[model samples]
Target: MSYDNNSAATPGYFNANRTATVTVNEHNFNAAEVNAQITAALQGSGVAAPGLGGWSTNGDVHTASVTFSADADYTFDVDYTDLAGNAAADYTQDKFTVDKTDPEVEFFDIEDKSANNGTVAPGVKYSDVNYMESGVDITIKGAKHDKTELSGNRTNIANGESIKMEDFKHDEETDDVYTMTAVIKDKAGNETEKEVMFSVNRFGSNYIFSETTEKFLDDVYANKPKDLVVTEVNVDSLVFNGISYGLDGTKKELKAGSDYTVKQSGGEGSWKEYTYTIKKENFEKEGRYSVTIDSEDKATNKMNNKVKECNIDFVIDKTPPTVVITGIEESSYRADEREMTINLSDNTAVKCVDVIIDGKSVATYAQKEIEKAGGKISYMIEGASEPQKIEAAALDMAGNETTSEMHKVLVTSSVWIQYINNTPLLIGSILGIVLVAGGLIWFFVIRKKKEESK
Candidate 1:
């Protein structure tokens, strides 16, 4: 019963027992950005805390997320405490990898043009489109065009680092500019597409050549011997891939064997250029003419783009030139002295004019021969005159010649005609002069008589 008070505190020397201890936040996990998952291993230790964005964790477990700060590796830090702020560590530095950019597909070479991109097999309408990368395919489609362009997702292109896509049509349909789109894809289902348009230029660049027209006259004279070829044929009726290309003023250069089927009959493909021949429209001389040159071919596009005609138009002038003489008439006598005016002109140009008097080139008429052939000729009477005949001979650049169309003028000198026109005026002037002299003399005589009477 004694020792009831013996339950006192244990004395100094023998008291030793652990009350508190230190621990760390430990967590570990791996992740990828593709799964859209945020990973955490905070259970049994650290509190799951959010990392660099797009990551969130409750006090217990981590949640999954499609959102992330960026497509790059990331780390999630988990912190822990034993009871208070005693111990802590980055529980998990989980690594996450991401890839976001689309793969690039290269097609044409920047250098070494003319190298085959691929379509170089016989009867193939296309050429090469070489590539320098892996995991890419080209599928061409002209959804807006005919079936020939609808290449349903072509994947059979020969595979290589230098992959080639052959057999792309080289010729454009008549009057139509076509578009071809290539859809490129890779192993991961990534895709890209590019479209190219081929313009219709089948008849060639040098299509039409002609002359100047001045409203009233189409100067076929400008083309001279060669002539202009003009005719209408429907160039748009060309059919390719079972579709007709309607006319729209398109001139495509011949792709020859690339566009049309080759045949052995009638001159090795009917696209022979019309051989130009020089012909004169001279039998009838002066007239308007529309000359033509045509070659037939069911296969090739015509020279001027139409299937019906390739022609030329020109005119040849062979009309005789005329000379005009103005001054005197046949057997006329004129009191006045004047020169005869001559004018010679032609459609081309006047070459020379000749003056023949009594069938001889007279020196008295300095214009016995004029290169321009017509201007004016002076006449002078030096002796008792006899009737003289005058005529003009004119020639033109086209070698056509004609004398003055009017009857020749016969000129003669006349003294009687000169007197009647001048003699009466001369006699009146002498009588006026004598009357004035008589009045002055009479005035002087009267002055002397007045002085004598004074």
Candidate 2:
């Protein structure tokens, strides 16, 4: 059976098999000592020498080429030797194999922003993203960014993957300068921070403006400019009851029983003037009249009108004189006296003093008698037959009259008669008896002597 398949055997069974080549590429060495150690390891591992079917090198580098059985696992040990061909001390031979695979990153993400330490506007917030081995966790920090820190714990922050800055409130107490910061960490334990500055200011509303002064109002109302010009309607003064009226230029006076118009002197076309009338009865009754000038200028239409007030004083002597008795002397006197003197005075100047006896007027006395006697007037009472009543009436410059009370007086022919009449009856009877007795004795004696002689 074995010889029967000789002619059917696979073609080219006698052809030689291709050999498996083991080529070593150059190794990356960071230090020349490390490269020398690697070259010694290859040489001491029983590998063929360089350029002798095992490895080759230009100068300091060495390469190896070899063939191995297919589908067979092989293990070998690398022994490092020193430059003297002896075992090297403090040298490590690390085994490595090439599988052509990608390496894995333990943690990967962008680092979150860190807490900023600069100015920031109020009522604003900041945030950042972070990564970790497990997952992303956010951390937050908040504060009044526009205010100064009072305590050491003013900053509120957390340590995590991601971070978010809380919003800050802006109030009237907030300062103009502000700062905000953000801190963030990544999966690799890396941290970053950022800061920003901003400005805060207060706003205001709008309004209108106005202007006015008190001096302007006073000047407009006082009419200080119209003090000069004279008008045709002006008069020198007002007269009444024999008295002339003149003002101190502070007020205007009008004639009695006359009506007049007062203005600023231009005319009716100018500012309107005040109009008033002087009634004769008022002047006659009160002896004086007063009026005020309160006028207006209708040219400029205004809510508040211009006005002026002054006292207008007028003189009128319509009042009658008032008489008063200032002095009087004699209350009683003898009627036989040559003159009766009286002292008198009046409120006004005395014009005359009249002697009135028993309701009858005596014309013998003159005003000259009262004036020359210094207000004492004497009247002849010698011719009066009996005790009579005498009085005096005074007339003043204004024709006012005042009368004195009647005075009592006695009139007698002789002093002896008066003495006898007023004497008691006992005194008169003694004198009468003596005179009768004497007359009777003389008559009787004469008769007796004649008879005896016959």
Candidate 3:
């Protein structure tokens, strides 16, 4: 006779309802005397004999079994004897344990985190999403078990090594938040899992804010200071936007000290501010310019200023507008008011136009008026006997001014001179009549004297 039950328990582990049994296979005459002794015991509850009712027979086989019903470590033993009084080796099993418990896991306290502007939820560290851009250092701790596994956005994370903030950055288009799960398991197949969530901020458009109104500024004017600022915190390295192309088709980046200058404050874990002033030499000529500032946060995250707000685009209009005075002749005499048209043009839009006579501004037209009139302004200069130095001036948004060539006009504004110049046909006809009248009188006198003498 031998133990016949096949227990599914692991070598030294057990679950509910496991059984142990014994079987006898003999065709002897005295089968009624065949019997087996069985002893089963739970760890804390001393040993006891199982209720193994006399064996049941089927053909030449007899079998008996006992089932375990409680949760605990158990030990079992069995001794078998044949019908003819032949003894068999005893079978014994030890330390089959039943367990139903879970493990615990957690992350270590994160340090070296930047200042956060956002509020934190309970049990969540590094509260602000922007803080990740500057990068934080973290690791795992407080996990006790046979084996630990990690899953989610990040897995197979080194147990004690520093984890960079970039590791937690997920695809912003799909999900801006990142979650990681840590699972800890015990040798008895019991396990527990905990989740850690992180927020991330990726590259996007930036904005230029107005200090006075705290609103966005769409245009940059030359009258304003050439200051560029950033809102990101904890900036480490900065790269200004300026380039020069070589004859060999290669380009070189502009230098900070030579090409531009920078002033920075409040960073390395706090709100950061940067002011870049482009040198005047770079804008010696007048035109529109595009500039960019590319940089990296403390975590080595790239912050490119290629987007609208972050990029710099403005007119560097150092060149003045052109001015022309029409409908007036230089040094011409006029006894009546002469209407002159002032034409203005510039690379950019003209800001204003001024009509000046002698040394004072006679009239001024604003940008709107100039634009409404299509960059032309009509004005009449009062007639005067004395010559007048007239000039038309144009200005652009950059405060650049241009004055037209001085025109000395209305040199002789006398009414008689003006009449003589305009009524030439009438004067000629009157002079012809006087000459004919005098010649006719002289000829008649000559004829009368000749006839009398004859």
Candidate 3 residue-wise lDDT, 69-159, digit = tens: 5444555655556666776665554345544434334453321222221332212122211111122223332211122223223333222
Which portions of model 2 miss their true places by more than 4 Å? 1-336, 364-369, 416-454
Model 3 residue-pair collision total: 0
Q: Give per-residue CA lDDT, model 2, range 1-454, as digits (tens).
A: 0111122112211111112222222343222222222211221243322221344555555543332212111232233343544442442432221111111111111121211122321221222222222322222232223342212112222322222223333443332223444443332233445544332322110011111212322222221111111111111111111112233333344442343323222232121112232233323332233333221122221111111112233333322323223233332333345465666664324667777777888754445665677776656675344456667776654445667767665455565544544445547777789888988898799989999999
lDDT of each: 0.36, 0.34, 0.53
Q: lDDT: which candidate is best? A: 3
In terms of TM-score, the best-performing candidate is: 3
Off by over 4 Å in 3: 1-252, 256-280, 296-302, 306-308, 331-336, 382-387, 411-454
When sorted by TM-score, best at the front, the candidate numbers are 3, 1, 2
TM-score of each: 0.26, 0.25, 0.40
Model 1 lDDT per residue over 273-347, tens place: 222212222213443444322333344534333332222333445766566767656644553444666665566
Q: By TM-score, is 1 or 3 better?
A: 3
Worst 10-residue lDDT window for candidate 3 reads 124-133
lDDT of 2: 0.34
